[model samples]
Target: MLGNDLPPPTEVINMYKLNQIGLMRIYEPNHEALKALRGSGINVLVGVRNDELQQLASTESAAEDWVAAYIRPYWPQVNFRYIAVGNEVIPGEVARYVLPAMQNLHNAWSSGVLNSIEQIKVSTAVAMSVLGESYPPSAATFSQDTAAYMVPIARYLNSIGAPLLVNVYPYFTYVENPSDVSLPYALFASESAVVIDDGLSYYNLFDAMVDAVYASLEKAGAPQVRVVVSETGWPSGGNGNVTTPSTAQKYNSNLIRHVLSSHGTPRRLGKSVET
Candidate 1:
């Protein structure tokens, strides 16, 4: 999903149908994939490349031009749900462009330049590194250095109806501290003992991680904003035993069931997530 190049449109369509995948996220707008997905009934989330953020953020005209060129051409035919301003670029060198680009894009969409704007939202994606302290879930808060940028982004997201997109990987956590983090806990094993934090029980790492973001939002005075898991997966190839097929299988399968069951994190009980 990160690359601009993709498989043939026909093959992609066939694969999506075969796998019953109703939604897809592409890192950048790949015309071939968009063409293939057109009228396929599959919802898509297209991205703005990090390098192009400066241009888009500089002026509303640039953002409008981008939408006109990349999105309007396939309007109605392609069900684009969100315009991902940037992917996992938060807290990096280009972090400054995240919010501005989102604002410009939102302005463009709301200007009625496009046929449909209500159906599309604007946001950026971030990784767990944005949090200074993620343990205990309740202790989570944006890092001091990044809070200046993150708080505004959160506020903007809350003002609009967009969710804070984040990419969480418990696999990386387990790999980094295998001695302390249990594999079963990371894999969502039903038999694993619940890790109690703030008197609430966390049955798996995914929920705990998600609750951390919620805690951060609450601290930032933007608790109303929702959090969406834009990306998550166990690696099939890596440096250690953490990349085994069986581990990937358990994590992905249980994750699907956990998310689909309408189970929200402890911080937001009964309120389903939009990941």
Candidate 2:
């Protein structure tokens, strides 16, 4: 959720505790949000913007300085687990700077300044646009044009044991091709029959999309790199079978149940997922 949508930072943390939300992702390291989250016990994944990539990528010193300024001040208290180097950056804009920026940030985290601190995982968020094909949960492949940028990024994430973060929105798919993608499948409801592809049955569009990303990672020769859904939600108000409040409720409720079940996707069963 965007910081603006929430109440004051301290109240936000209180609300999260009240709701039992174990983890939250903040797009930027807003001082108030970080400060409020301090000692709240809720985990956070703070982000670095594409605009800041150039600055952080310029020098190792700059990356270290960023860590010093934004991260260290709210250390063990905030429970910040990951440093998202960039958000939805691939195939359209800021593609070139993604990997280099990640490397510099990771290097900075590993430097002596933060050596005692648990090394925060460094990664970038990618959109489904990076995939050339994402159907059947088996034929997904990285776009050829993005290979130069994606291959190295995948390899680096694999080596560091960091998951590949990708935003998957079934809402967009249904909105774009409502005639083909049914509302039930998109909403994680049982109104529709399961769609079988490559001998695997897909009861929900979310699993299919996630598995498609796994297949793409395999095609990129980064099969060891785990795929994590960085963002996914259905809008409460919009025209269409999938975008209504009822459908959104069903989708979100079922999504929560599916996640808490800890039963991974059909393609990678038994593997736990991080939202």
Candidate 3:
């Protein structure tokens, strides 16, 4: 769902009206929306905007006040499920804020005022760029620079029982090397046979990408951490060469079918993914 820079109250009422029409989830930074839609049944995922992270990290009191003022009052009324501390913090210019934002979020979560802290989850989303190399299946790994930052973050997330959220896009891989990367393979349909560790076979790119993340986590010594794909979708419209509607429909349809079929990965055969 799209959000705005508007203050909490206005955005909350606006979202409530939008929710009535079928937009169930909204991403926002304001707490007033939580209060406005209290008991309204709308799901909200709050964000810690980058600009505010410096302030939030500077002092524990700031984090406490922000949560108490924006989140505490709306408790039990608003369905606050996730607190995303930073967006794409791993591989971009905002890497500096990743640690601090995470620390502040933990402080806020530990504060007893929120009431729903145990039920609510705190996490950060990362872009696919965090992977240093993703091709050839086996060579895929996290960048040394990213690992320098992600290693400790992964440990902390594991310590808090938060899953590592990654945004993967096989479409970009196909677009970048369409000649070698088959569309069906990227779409999670056809079998593109490739053996990894000279034994395990890979049929689709999605699993390959996932396994790459799994490998990174293993290398980081946070092997038990669960990885979640926070975002993955085909664009419905784009330029003639890449974003044509026909290609979009084909990709999306195939993806939906694959997901609904409940086909587990080679590494996780017969084990259905719940989400």
Candidate 4:
């Protein structure tokens, strides 16, 4: 779910079976495993390496070439559902590549790599660092440094009908500020009072975090763009101080139930989120 670089095919298959994971994220597209796992009903999200981003962004030819070599050959055989142009290219040195990478992915799709341009979808995953300030639920907003880039990025993603992918973890938030953040609130274990804004009440941290992103998008003038949670989970094991098996189960189980029970965030009530 985190790293795409995996071991050999046999080992990867065994690991997938061992963990009962139906979905996997791979860095480089692999044709052999795609063929081998065809009937296994596994979903894979592939990526274009960072080094290739600049080339892919700047030239339509490069994207077409990359897709033809890395994607088309394995097409129909591999259940390639999503193609992430680049990973976490925001709010850091890599931020410069975000816009170009997005443009390239869009150009690739427009180039008609697939017989039907409507068949394949592309998106880029972003880290929470993209947010300028995300705290106290209502105060969360995109940072100025990221905003200049995010605004255009969000617009391009919207133009291409791609969801904005983000990785959020309330566990990390709570651990970072235990003195201020309540555990039950972070884990969605609390039935306590909710945080209300503009007459909307947030019942959990997950929804609040999502709404924060939604708000940021609205502020960026891309309110129609959908937000997808590319990653969110609790680790079962970590340094004794931060994590343990018991807490991990409690956190992840409850989070799963919370997501399953909801169709969309308060900001986009009743609307279906790509997730």
Candidate 5:
């Protein structure tokens, strides 16, 4: 989705079907992609553009219109799932608008023609920067600047029983400190437990990073809220000496196997993760 070189949406859907990848997340409503998703039976996580937050927050009508144009037409056939209100907007200029936009969108989704349709939960996607502390997962808390909005957003998601979408990138963390963060640990190739926090063992960076966000949610007074790792992947190439196709394949291969299992994480045992 990051480049124009990708296959047509129809072919992409076919590829997903052939590979049995049941879930797909598109950053925005690509009409053709949505059309292509019709009857594909692939549950989709769709996003609301960050720029559209202000307008959607301004009026419930805007959210309603948005649903009419984007969602109403192909819902059942498209298998619409989560609707991300904003992606990584917290701590940014429009951070203040996210919660309101989510509220409005949720209201619109719950009170219109779309209302009768099963819930398509509204939540925001956040990056690792939102965490104030991350080393010891149990000690993680939302950074001061982001907490003002993140806490409320977390609570709102809890109120609506929606899971928080997190973008977890061990690559960024590893690249920043390769010496401290071993490549095997970052890529989920660690053969032994690397860290122990609050008596919970962590074998890989992905779980640690995700557990950090979970801990932050606990402190945010939304401990009951679940987490959805909306995005997580390693670079296939580009970084000098660091990026390689084999490494990328290894990381993703292990990642998929891990998440697809019912083992979950040490923090949330037996609960399968939705990647």
Candidate 6:
């Protein structure tokens, strides 16, 4: 949906099935997409727009209504997996409403309307900027300003048996600090280990970024909570050499291979979670 020339919802769903894409995460409640997803069998992680956070946090009923309108109707047919309350709204003004939105949405979902199906959990999506210190992965911690919001949200997600959704963009990290962040590491094309953190090895920037979030969660007293990568990609042609087609294809293919492999990240080896 981010592109200017995307096909219609039906065509898009067909392509997903044809390509065997198991899961999808949308940025907002796209009714056309929801309708097309019914009986499609592709797992879905739907997002609530950042603007919707204030309304959802304002009242429990508002949350319930949102679920009713965007989720309930498509139920088991849509294979709803998770409801993201907000995307990258933290470290800013509306950060105050993120947890409240999650709480209200959780209450609405657990209010017996959708009690029969506990699989459709509620959480929020955030960017890597929430972490103040991310290098060395293990030593990562949330920034002072964002901690007030992330800490509570982490605990809430842990309590509800839901995973925190994070948008980890190694490409941006590489471009921002090309002098330090190498292209091979950012694309997961490195042959040898890159960073060694507390006996854990990291060969790619993606793992480092994700582990940083995990470290932040643990520091926030929510070590048990999981993380789902809500968004990640390499630009196709926006920039010059760094955003060429060759690099984009390599990054996308390597990412898929890395995720499908049996071995997970250094910090979470042998443990699997959705990407």
Estimate TM-scores for all models: 0.94, 0.94, 0.79, 0.85, 0.97, 0.97
- Please provide, for model 4 over 1-275, each residue's C-alpha lDDT reduced to its tens digit, 9 standing for 90 to 100: 24578566767777787877767777666666665666566667787787777777777778777877876676666666678767877766766776776676667656544755445568778877778776544566789878888888888877878788787887777778788778777777888655777777766777778878887887777878888777887777765745778777887887766665655667778755444
Worst 10 residues of 1 by lDDT: 109-118
lDDT of 2 by residue, 1-275 (tens): 45456567788788889999998888988898888888899878889977898888888888888888898899878887778888887875677888888888888777676776655788889888888888877998888877788888998998888888888888888788778888778877755447788888888888888998899888778889887777888898857544678777887888888877768898888886678
Model 1 misplacement above 4 A: 1-6, 113-115, 190-193
Tens-place lDDT digits, model 5, residues 155-256: 999999999999999999999988899999999989999998989999999999989998999999998999999998989899966789998999899999
Estimate, for each residue in 168-268, the C-alpha lDDT of model 3 and write its tens digit. 78888778888887877876667557536436677778777777777777777787777666667777666455676777787767655665565755555
Predicted candidate 6 versus true structure: per-residue lDDT over 97-216, tens digit per residue:
989988988888786858876888898889999999999899899999798898989998889899999998999899999999899999999999988889988999998998899998
| TM-score leaderboard ranking | 5, 6, 1, 2, 4, 3
After aligning candidate 3 to the native by TM-score, how far in Å is the CA of 115 from where it should be?
A: 5.4
Model 5: lDDT equals: 0.92
List runs of model 5 lying over 4 Å from the truth: none
Best by TM-score: 5
lDDT value for candidate 6?
0.89
User: Between the candidate structures 2 and 6, which one is better when assessed by TM-score?
Assistant: 6
lDDT by residue (63-170, candidate 1, tens digit) is 989988888888789888888898878788888988999998888878664635667888888899899999989999999978988999999999998888898899
